[model samples]
Target: MKKIKIIILFTILLLPKLVFASNATIAITGVNTAAVGNNIKMYVTLSSSAAIGSWELTLNYDSSFLKLIGSDADNGGTFMANKVAGASGINKKVYTFTFRTLKAGNTLLSIGSSSLYDFDTMGEMTVRTYNKNLKIMTQQEIEASYSKDNYLKSLSVDEFEINPVFNKDTLEYSVEVPENTKTINIKAVANDNRSTIDGLGEKEVVVGNNKLNIVVRAQNGSERIYILNVNVIDKNPIEIIIDNVTYHLVKYKEYLTIPSGFEETTIKMSDIDIPAFYNKKINYTLVGLKDEAGNIYLYKYEKNKYERFLELKLGNLKLTPLSIGNKVLNYEKETIDFDGKIDVYKIDKRFKLINAKNILNGEEGLYLLDIVDKTAVKYDLKDIYTLRKLNKIYLATTIIFLSTTALSIIIMLSFKRKPKIKDKEQKVKEKTKKELPKDEKVVKENKKNK
Candidate 1:
C-alpha cells in the first residue's frame, strides 16, 4: 500500500512536467466583441516544432449564441478537407471557422480532446490548448456608441474673415477675396469627434460668386451642409450691347432662375469663364444678362450673338416663340380690348411663319390676325384647306338642288290652273261690254242665244 501511494504521487508530479514540456500548441483567435447579426471568423491554428502526421479536434461553442456558418482548412500551401481522415502530414495548419452571432452575450469557443500524431513514429504528441472568449453586443449598445451630432463646431477661411462672424448655428457665409486670388483655404471641424467632415481644404475660386459646401456626416449617418459664398473681385468686367442697350455679364448667379432639364455650365467670353445653363435637347446655351439698371434676364447665346429669350403672355395664352431668327414676325405690342395685351404683326409680307411653339400647352399653327380686331388663332393649314373645300362643295350642291326644285313647282302650277294670258283677255272683253251701254249689252246677249 505504501509503495502504491508513492507510485501514484510520482505519476501526479510527472504529469505536470510533461504538460509544461510540450513543444506543440493549438490556439483559437478571433475578435473579442461583436454585434448581434454580425458574422465573425475564428482561426484555429496548430503550431509544432516538427511536422506531424495528422490532427483531430472537436469544436465547442454555445449553439444559442453562435451558429456555425462555414469553415476552411489550410495546411501550409495545401488544403486539408473537413473529413476526419485524409492523407495529412503538416508542421503548421490553420482552420478558419465562420460563425453568425445570434444573441447578445458572452460566449466561449474551445477545442475538446484534440490529438496530434507524430510524423515519424506515428505516435501521439502532447500540445498546449487554448480557447477564445467573445462578447456579443445588442443593437442598443451599438447605437449608444455612435454619435448623431452633425453640426460643425467651427468654420474658417485662411487669410480672410468670415462674413457676419462665425457661429455654429449659422450655416451660410460670404467672403470676398482679391481679383488675383485663385484659391482659398477652408477649414471645418465637427461638433463630435466621432463625426466626419468633408469639403474642407483648398477650394478653387472664380472671378465672381463661388459656392463651396462643407458637409458633416455623423457616425449615425446623419448629415448637414454649410455653404460658403466666395466672391473673387473682378476689376475689369465684360460688356456687351443688345438692341442699343448696354448689358454686363452677371456676377451673382443666385439671382438667376434655371430652366427645367437644363444643367448649370460655364462659357468662355474673352478668356473669362461665365456661368451659363445648357439644355442638350434644344442644343442651346443661355447666359444671364444684367442690364445697366440692375435688371437681370436670361439671354440665348448663339454664334457670338445674344438675344433676349422672349416670353409673351397674352390673356391666358403664354407664348415662347423661337426668337433666334425669322421664326417670328416683327411686331409692336398693342393693347386690344379683347386680348388685353397683343402683338400686332404682318404675316402677309413674311414667309409661311413656322417654328412658334406654345410654351404653356403644345399646340400648332399660331397666328396673329391683322384684321379689324387683332387676335391670335390656333389653326392647322391642312385642316383649314380641307374644311374650306368641303364648305364650297356643300354651298354649290344646295344652290343647284334648290333651283331644280323651284322650276318643277312652277311647271306643276301651270298644269293645275288656266292660262294667265286667256284669263286676262276674257276679263278685258267683259269690262268693255259693260262700259258700252245697257241696250247694246242686251242685243249682244240675244245674238249669242240665237
Candidate 2:
C-alpha cells in the first residue's frame, strides 16, 4: 500500500510534465512577405506529440517583428468536449498573428517554450524581404511651369505701342511688345538734372512667375528702372497706366476722371493722331489736361469729355474766452457759412475771445454769447452767489476739522500717562493689609490711623 501511494504521488507530480511534453510541438506553418508600409497575417498550429492528460501551454516568441494578435487554444482542450475523458488525448491549438513591416530589411520570428516544463519544441521563421520606395521631384521643372501661366498671358512688344513718358516717383512705365514673352530685358534713358546718374540704365526681369517678386525703384533723379513681370502669354498690347495716366494703349476703353479737389483746364496729346474714321472707331488717343494749380493730368481718350470738383469740407469752429479783464467788449453775433466738411469745435488760444486766466484769477462780471445759424445764445460768465456761499462753508468746515483734530491729539497724549512707582507701592501695601489675619489687620489698621 505504501509503495503504491508513493508511486501514485510521484506519477501525479510528473503527470503534468509528461502531458506538456506530449503536447509541446511547434511548427512554422506559413511564411509571408510585405512592403515597408504594409502588413501581413501568419497562421501557426500546435498539436500534441503523444497521448497526454490535462496540461497548460505557454508560447514565447520574438515580438520585435511579429506579434501574437490572437489565439484559440481552448478549442483543443476539454472545454470543447462533452466529457473530460473525450478531450483527454492529443489536442490541437491554432494561433493567428499580425505583423507590421518596418524598414527595408529582413527579420526573424521565433517561437519556443516559455519554461523547462513546457518541453523542447522550438522553431523560427523569416520574412523573405521588406522594402520601401520613395519618389521625389526637381525644383527647376516646378518653377518653369509656374512662370509660363502667371504673368505672360497679355504681353505685347511692338514699335508703335510704347509710351514716351516715364514716371520717376512711382517707377512705372508702359511698353509695347510684338510677342508676349516670359522674361524681358528693358533699357530706359532719361536725364538726371542735366547730369547722368551711373547705373541708371538697364535691367532684366522674369515676369508672371511666383518665384520672382517684382519691384520698381528709381535709380536717379529723373530716371526710374521698372523691374516688372510679364507672365501673360497673349500677344495683345496690354495698356499699362500708372497714376491714372495712359503710358501705352493697345485699345482705349474710358478716360481717367479728374481728381476730387481739381478741375480740368487743358488737353495735350501725341503729335500723331489716327484719321477721324479710325479715331472714332478705335478709341485710342493720348490726352492731357491741367488743374487750377497747374498740376498736369494725362490719360487715354475714350469718352467725349472730363471735369473736376472739390472733395473735402471744413470742420467745426469754436470760440472761447481766455480772460475777462475789468473792461469787457460787446460785439454783435454773426454766422459764417463753411463750404467744407466740419469735424469738431476747438476752443484753444487760437479761438479765444479773452484770456481765461484773468477771469479765473480776478473778480470780474462777464457775459458769453454764442452765435449759431445767425442766432445769439447768451450766458452769464460768473456765479457770484454760489461762490460766496461755497467760500463761507469751506472756511467753517476747515476750522471745525482743525480744532477736532487738535483735541483728539491732546486726549491721546493724556491717556498715555503711566502711574508712578510710589502709587503702585501704596496700592500693594493696602492690598496686603486687607488680606492679613484679624489681629495683624487690627494692629496694622491702628498704626495706619495713628
The numbered model that scores best in TM-score is 1
After superposing candidate 1 on the true structure, give the runs of residues whose Cα lies further than 4 Å from its correct spot: 1-40, 45-58, 73-94, 111-133, 137-141, 151-175, 181-194, 201-203, 236-298, 301-450
For model 2, how does the per-residue alpha-carbon lDDT over 1-450 read when each residue is reduced to its tens digit? 999999999998887653212324544444444454445555554455443333333434444444444444344321111112453444454455555444444555444332212222322211122122221123343233231111111212233232434344433344533333323444433332233323222333222111112222223223323333333222332334455753332122122343222333333234333212112222223344332221333433456443211111112212222223333323322222222222223233223122211111232223222323311122343555577689899999999999999999999877665456668889999988878777786999899999
lDDT tens digits, residue span 1-450, model 1 = 999999999998888543232357889998988999999988888888866777777677899999888776443311333322456557777888889999998999888777777765566778888999999999889777778899998999999988978887888999899977878999988889989999999976655657788999999888889998887777877888988987778754565777655689988888877889876655668898866434567888999898666444444544545422423335333323322222333355431233344654545345554334333456466776798799999999999999999999999999767678789999999998887898887999999999
lDDT of each: 0.73, 0.36
Best by lDDT: 1
Q: What number of clashing residue pairs does each candidate have, in the order they appear?
A: 0, 33
TM-score of 1: 0.43
